[model samples]
Target chain A: METVVQQLLNAAQLGAVYALIALGYSMVYGVIRLINFAHGDIFMVGGFAGLLLALRFTWMPLWALMPLAMLLTALLGVAIERVAYRRLRQAQRMSLVITALGVGIFLENLVRLGVGPETRQIPSRMPTTPVAWLQDALGVSVTWDKLLIIFVSLALMALLWAVVHRTLLGTAMRAVADDKDVVPLMGVNLNRVIAVTFAIGSALAAAGGVFFGQAYSLDPYMGIDLGWKAFIAAVIGGIGSIEGAVLGSFLLAGVEVLTVAYLSSNLKNGIAFGLLILLLLIWPSGLLGRPASKKV
Target chain B: MSLLRLEQVSVAYGAIRALHGVDLEVREGEIVSLLGANGAGKSTILRAVSRMLPLQGGDILLGGRSVRATPAHELVALGVAHVPEGRGIFPSLTVQENLALATWTRRERRHVEEATRRVFRLFPRLAERRTQAGGTLSGGEQQMLAVGRALMTGCRLLLLDEPSMGLSPLLVREVFRAFQEINAEGTTLLLVEQNAHMALKIAHRGCVLENGRIVLEGPAAELAGHPRVREAYLGEAGASSPPCPGTPGSSR
Candidate 1:
């Protein structure tokens, strides 16, 4: 029973990180309808940004360091949209997609050259001590860092949900997602809404990067693998839905963690990909995605 | 001064020019109907005025200031609201949310609520379905929601494209009556319509557009009785008279 509980904690921690990254994928896709192949690279950039900030400001607290890194990464995201994506908006879908891939490649190379190909960890800021209550009650070992990561991520998700569902800016974002051309008719600036979307998406991904860097190690190419996993999570949950992305992340993490625990670790990717294919066959629009209802 | 004036305005869709040197004016507190066949540049004129389309020549003036350089989104704050063809309401949004979105320029909470209450007062059918998704509404209700959404912008000038399209005759009369009320409350209207008979009846002045140019312009009554308009637009075949010269093919 303790073992089961510990594995669940592990799954939750990993899922939190995935959800952070998956949300960016979902939001950018929601507003622009672009798959944004460069998103994983942006996640990589975020991790690196956190690492650099941690190294420079050794006295900074986790709360302060994380937000600063997020702000920096958010600016990078807006710049990417302005310089790379905005001009190609009216062009063919294929062009936008190819451009995204190119941007991803450029980010990867820039980081690899600047930071070197060696893997490095962000100096740990979260408490490593096991929670006394959990250890006493459940007879399981769960560290404060893991608990903090999970709780912080959940809080961020909640805040995001409120912004999207309750706020005026968020409503404008949904309006853009619903019918982009008609959004300006409502006196909402379409470009400003889109830029804000990118900023929020990137900021969340940066938070994920900071957590991941502290928990694991960061290499420049780490984004390629983890980003794909998060993208899959977003897709399985429904690419354009915030709730779907969170649900998909936890579900995907649970599956992966269980597969490695009960079965061969080598079969993890095979099973995860297979689950995506099977789920899509049954529900082609992902778990939470509304079926296309565009009026003619 | 005219509420809107289009002076020698021209618009092009790539290589094809949709409007060519068209000059027109809508005085304040007047309903000016732009009557045209399909592709006669009626919608194009509205698009240019709302800054949705770039002008290749000439300028559009709103209250004596040239609006040629203004972005499309800012035009709403400038008190120009356009209801495009096909009732452009966000289908997934509830009727209340749809109206709330148009008040983006209005920062005060009380003002937004006031504007919303006024819209609900204007269209009580919309008020009944305030929480219902816009897509679920009937065609006439969707039209009401679209116009109501426009009113929430506190616009002084309302530009409508085919407000009568795809509605039953009864619904058409109901919407036109609402427009009369909206105008009566001090809004100027530029109405584009293929339903020429209803448009002429509501309009104070009318202009006939053909092949991207104004072919006829006069009081609504004069255009309604003109032989060419009667034969081409009103579907009234002149008895014992030859086909009116330059009569275009029937509008779809």
Candidate 2:
């Protein structure tokens, strides 16, 4: 039971981060219907941004650094959209995919030029002091780090829900997803809405990057695997729904963590990917999505 | 003076020209019903004015300035809002969000809230289902939501495409009545409909389209009483204006 409890906490902690990253994937897909291959590296750049900030400005509160990282990465996301995506906005998905791939290669190579393709420590962004919890009932003492991860993640999710549901910008986003062509008729500037979408989505992923750096290790390649996993989660949870992204992340994380604990540690990734393949084979629409039906 | 004009506008889908040299206009503050059979380039005019399609040639002018080459997104700034067929309400969005999306440029939260209330008053059904997802709404409610969404845009000029399609007679009456109320409030409406009788009944003026051209156009009452329109369009509304079979099988 203790082992199971430990695995559950581990899964939740990891799932929280995946949920954040998956939002980026899901939102971009919702608005543009593009895979956005560079999205994974946006997280990478965010971690690096946090890393650089941590190195240069050590005195600021840890909380400040996290948001700053998100802001920085969001700005970069906008820049990437401007440079790579803007021209391709009118292009076919296939053309956009190719451009996205090229951008990914460019970002990876750009990072290589500066940071040189090496693994680095995220540095302890949170305090090392442990906070004990639920040892008596669940027999698993949750650390402050994991607790912060879970609490902050849930908080971010709540905030996102409010902004998206309460604000006009959120409506524009939903409408834009439904029909990008008609929004301009409502007097909305499509370019501005799209920029804001990319900003918010990338910013969310950046927060996830900061969490990921603390929860795991930092590597350029880290975003690739994590990005792929999050995409699978987005697909599994229903690609366009934000709730679906979060739910899917938790499910994928639960499976992966449980496999790591009971099943072969080496087979952890294989199990995750295996489940994704099986899922897509059965339900291509994701768990929460209704298959598209339209009157011609 | 016309509020909207299409001067020899041509729209093409690849090699096939959907609208070739189509000319149309909407006078200021007038409810003009554009009537046509399917594929008679009825929708093509709206699409061109809304600039949703790539214009192959010719020009569209709103308020006498050319808009043919303008981006589709900028049309909203020109005070033109299109209520596309199928409502196009964001299925995943709640009723409030669908309304709120209309105020993107309004910026002031107060006006946004006020517009929400106004739209709610106009569409009490939407107000009742304020928290409901748009996907869950009935067809009538969805159409109401679409009209409400357009109202949120604050555009004085509205282009409605097939607003009465797929609606029952009762719902259709309700929709046309609401459109009348809207037009009464100083908003200009250009309505496209398969329900020509209902459209002409509400409209101040009307135009008849066939095979991508305007065959007849005049005051709503005059056009309603016209023999050809009476035979082809108004009979569906149970109006005994003309015999059902014109010349016994005249290529309907």
Local accuracy by lDDT, each model: 0.91, 0.82
Give the top-scoring candidate (DockQ). 1
Error of 2 at B90 (Å): 2.2
lDDT of candidate 2 over A1-296, digit per residue (tens): 77787789899999998998888888888888888888888887888777778878988677999999999899999988988898988788788999887877777777778876788766776765555447656667777788889889889988887877676777787778877866776677788888888999889888888888877867776778888888889999989888989999999999999988888889989999899889877888888765766633
**Model 2 misplacement above 4 A:** A1-5, A132-143, A278-284, A292-296, B68-70, B107-124, B225-252
Estimate the overall C-alpha local distance difference test score of candidate 2: 0.82
Model 2: per-residue lDDT, tens digit, B48-155?
Answer: 788887788888889999887788767776788889866777777788777777776565878777768777877788899998988789899999998988888777
Off by over 4 Å in 1: B238-252
Q: Which RMSD values do the candidates have, in order?
A: 2.2, 4.4
Given candidate 1, what's the lDDT at residue A88? Answer: 97
Per-candidate total of colliding backbone pairs: 0, 2
Per-residue lDDT of candidate 1, residues B45-131 (tens digit): 988898888899999999999999999999999999999988888887889888889999986888888888888888899999999
Q: Please provide TM-scores computed only on chain A for all of the candidate models, following their numbering.
A: 0.99, 0.96
Which TM-score values does chain B get in all models? 0.94, 0.90
lDDT of 1 by residue, A1-296 (tens): 99889989889989999999999999999999998888888888899999998898899998999999899999999999999999999999999999999999999999999999999999999899999999999999999999999999999999999999888888888888888988998899999999999999999999999999988889888888888999999999999999999999999999998899989899998988898888889888889988866577
